[model samples]
Target chain A: MSRPPYEPPAQSLTGQIVDALLVLAMVVVTLYLPLLLKLSGAGVTKAVQAAPTWESLGQNAVMAAQWEKLGFDPAKAAEIIGSRFDYSFSWGALALTALVIVGYFVVMLRWSDREYRDVIAERFGDDRPPRRR
Target chain B: MTDITPQNLAGVAAPAAEPVARRVALKRVLGPAHVWGLGVGIVLVGEFMGWNFAVGKGGAIAALTACWLAGILYTCVAMIDSEITSTVAAAGGQYAQAKHIIGPLAAFNVGLYLVMAYTMLEVSNAIVTGDLIEAFTHNMGLVGEVDKRAFMVLTIVFLAWLNYRGVLATLTLNLVITAIAFAAIVTLFLYVRPWAPGETLKHGDLLTGLPYGGLGILAAMHFGLWFYLGIEGTTQAAEEVRSPARALPLGTLTGVMTLLIAATITWYVGTGLMPWEYLGQAVTPLYDAARLTGSAPLEVFLFFGTLFATIASANGCINDASRAWFAMGRDRYMPVWFGAVHPRYHTPFRSIVFFVPIAILFAVSTPLDQTITLSILSGLLGYTLMALSVVIFRRKWPLGTIDRGYVHPLHPLPAILLLALCAVTYVAVFLGYGSQLLAMMAFFIVASLWFALHRYKYVRRGDQFTMRWPKPNGY
Candidate 1:
């Protein structure tokens, strides 16, 4: 059998404009919300501050002195040097994580299975074998 | 079922006597060893440097736990990837699988993930190469300050040139250098002589309880990814392999096993020689361990090992990342201009050259850890999608509907386990790099929107499902 011709779905200019605007809004919210609420943690800040000295050059004194040589603020280097990992565990975080995982698995399976069956039916007639146990 | 040939599977006509620009395909010359090299070459660099960061996060014991946990996660990844890629037998690896198994939007995102992950990794490797050279020159008391940027650019240029010339030569070079790097690790393990009395390793003095506790072990899982980050990259060469059925799975499984052994030895030697505090933060833990041995010859061998591992990683990154971009281009997900293969070389010349400056730019400008985090996050997203895609693949194309190169044991279980592990790793990343995580999500979301509104029109969507197969189940 010969291949079938395909036509792309219609996309309106207004719809495209709306999508662009929505994407912009999402990017803004996802990036700025944490900083706006001060929910951002020591992770990235500590990484930037600590990496040049602590990661590249060993020894706290040498790292601090390198910062001094570069004419950066001494307090910033000191804070970075003293940084430590937060070992506390939150049960709420764990619960939410579990919720997201289960929710995603269920949603993906349902949607993808539905969409896949539709694709097969469209491409290759509606004949299907019986389900196996 | 009808027998499948590359021409029939790809649904393309054979090339004419003279090379035709539009019809050229990637050369199929690779074997199991090249596949193994591509997988392991991309990841062995992790053993040299970034894995040590796990020690910093949770101490030695926590790091070891993270290693085992991440190993299980990647084993699931390898099995799932081998099965899917062996059947798909196309460039773009997981991207191609997503296109055929799921849909276009997923394919686009998976392709982007592959490109971003490998490109960022290439940048990191280049920067490490330059830094290693500068440090070497300084230690040798060279006459002048060595500029690392020049070496970084040169590394990218040389590798890109090699890739542009041919696939066989590029991966053959990778196989050689990757083996040497692996041998270096074994040599170090033998030199330390852990089995002999009064061995060099001082594990009794050095082993410590998890300094950060159990939560720290969870946190360390993110860095633990460094142990085998790019092994899934083996499948990127699926289309080029001589026999995708036998070679892909063999190469991928063996690659993971190699990493597991290498990771264990690296941890043992490192923690045995250095204090947990120092081992955790040391830039080159293995090299430093060699320094502790006070063997100049051993130190120099490891220095070359670190250097070669970094180079091999960058080389493989260029290969995988370009294949992804080229595959996307072939489908017009990106511009068709990048789809062109060099008529004689049979390489994706445009895609290979396209990423050269981008890698160099990021290498010079971006902070090392930031790039590393973004690469890992991109990889995690790809794995999550892979887990979901495999389930969809099995349900739609159940066992008897079509031929499969390999079938993963206990279907659905690996998928579910992969999903769970990916979720835990996502949480692990969020606990530490929450801002970067959010930022990466935003970037991909925007890119998806762009593809939907702007790029989708150019893609001949129906042509993407070219692979000949029996009707999917439940049709």
Candidate 2:
């Protein structure tokens, strides 16, 4: 049997123009929408202000100088550092998260088992032979 | 074998020359190592920089918890992707799988997701590369004020040219740099000697309880995605791999394992060296940790590590994004002109070149965090779709119906877990980035509408099914 010749669909100039404009609009929205939404607030200044200084660097000026030489702001590099984890527990949120995990697992197991068995039965008849493996 | 050339065939009539056009395909020269390179190269940059943001949101313990949770999510992703990609064996990765299992609109959306995710990541990488160089020159007192845009444009151009040349050379380069970046993380881990405790790492003083309680861990899952963001990209090279069935699963599974190890070491080293507050907000936490050691050689090693990881990531992004865009073009989901494979180089040259300007433009103008966030959201959406697609795939073409190189154990469990994890991750992201999440959804909805209304006319529906599989069961 002979196959038909392959010819791509013809696109009109107006159609092409519309595609180009549509693509351009998508690009614009992708690039600028996040910025307009104020998602870029995690800027450098906030990072510098929020960063805590290492206690070891405070006693050693030479090390601190090296850190500054590496482009970190020296003024922002002064503080006593310690473990900030205070074990403040949010029991409600924690319990909720745990419940979601356990509940989803049970639900998925039941649903998936039924669906998988159907597939198995469909592919191989109910009187299928035993596996060679 | 008989040699029946024109000269050898004395009386036999020559076969009639067909009028059909010749089909050009991507070269199949990649091995498992190249597959590993492509997967790891795109992700090792997370070890260098971004993952630490999780610590800022949820503290050290929370960050670690998020790391494990995200690990599970990507583990399911790797398994599901490996199984389906090994069967489909096409260039668009999830997009290709979606097209085969699901319908056109779903496939179209998945294609857009892949393109957007990798392209945005490429832009973020280029911007980071330029910023790293600028910071380096300034620290050395060699240059006063550097124009980062020049370096950003140069990085994109160089990578695009590399991608335009050939797949083998580009991935071989990725393998070398990715290995070095991975080694740097290992070296830092060894240098700290966590086993010896107080000699270097002060974990006793540094290891604290969860700062913001349990909810903080959920929040941290959003940034924890950085640890293994683009690992699923290994499947994007499916069409180019020499042995898609064996190589795809092997590379992807191993790649995920490697990321899990690296993420753990990165978290341990980072939290031990500095306070969680500082580590969370750090632009380059690993480099900052190296400097805290007061060792100049270690500092230099980490500096170069960060630079090389960034470059390698951008390189891998170019390869994956171009492949997805090229596949879409081949199916006429977009203009067919981008479907052209280079006759000499045997690459998606037009698609490779198409992204250079887009990457450069966004690299210079877009905020780094915004681009990263968008990329992550797109990737999460793709993962969610992948979970659904795999279930559909198994039901439509059950076991033994088609050739599967690697069948993931516990059918449908991975798919289900992937969905659950995706839902949790979405909630995590929404807690912090609700507005950006909504806006991105709007953007994809609009793009989907455009695909349905205008783009479908250009796509020849029947011709898009280029695979050699039999008609799907019950279809």
- All models, DockQ values? 0.15, 0.10
- Our model 1 lands, by Cα RMSD against the true structure, at 7.1
Every candidate's chain B TM-score = 0.94, 0.93
Per-model TM-score on C-alpha atoms = 0.82, 0.82
What is the C-alpha lDDT profile of model 2 across B1-475, one tens digit per residue? 1221222211212232221223456777889988988999999998888788788767799999989989999999999888888877777888877776776667777877888899988888888888877766765568478998898899999999998998889999999999988888888899888899877776666666676678779878888898999999998888778788889999999999999999999999988777665677677778778877777788788878888898899999999999998888877787777787887888899889887877877788876666787888889888887887888889877887666778899978999999988888876766556556666776776776677666766765444444545446653
Pairs clashing within candidate 2: none
DockQ, cand. 2: 0.10
lDDT of each: 0.76, 0.74
| Over 4 Å off, model 1 | A1-4, A7-81, A86-133, B1-23, B196-199
Clashing pairs in 1: none
Interface RMSD of each: 7.5, 10.2
CAPRI-style docking class of model 2 based on DockQ: incorrect
**Model 1 over residues A7-55: C-alpha lDDT tens digits?**
6554455654564355345434543345345444335323344344444
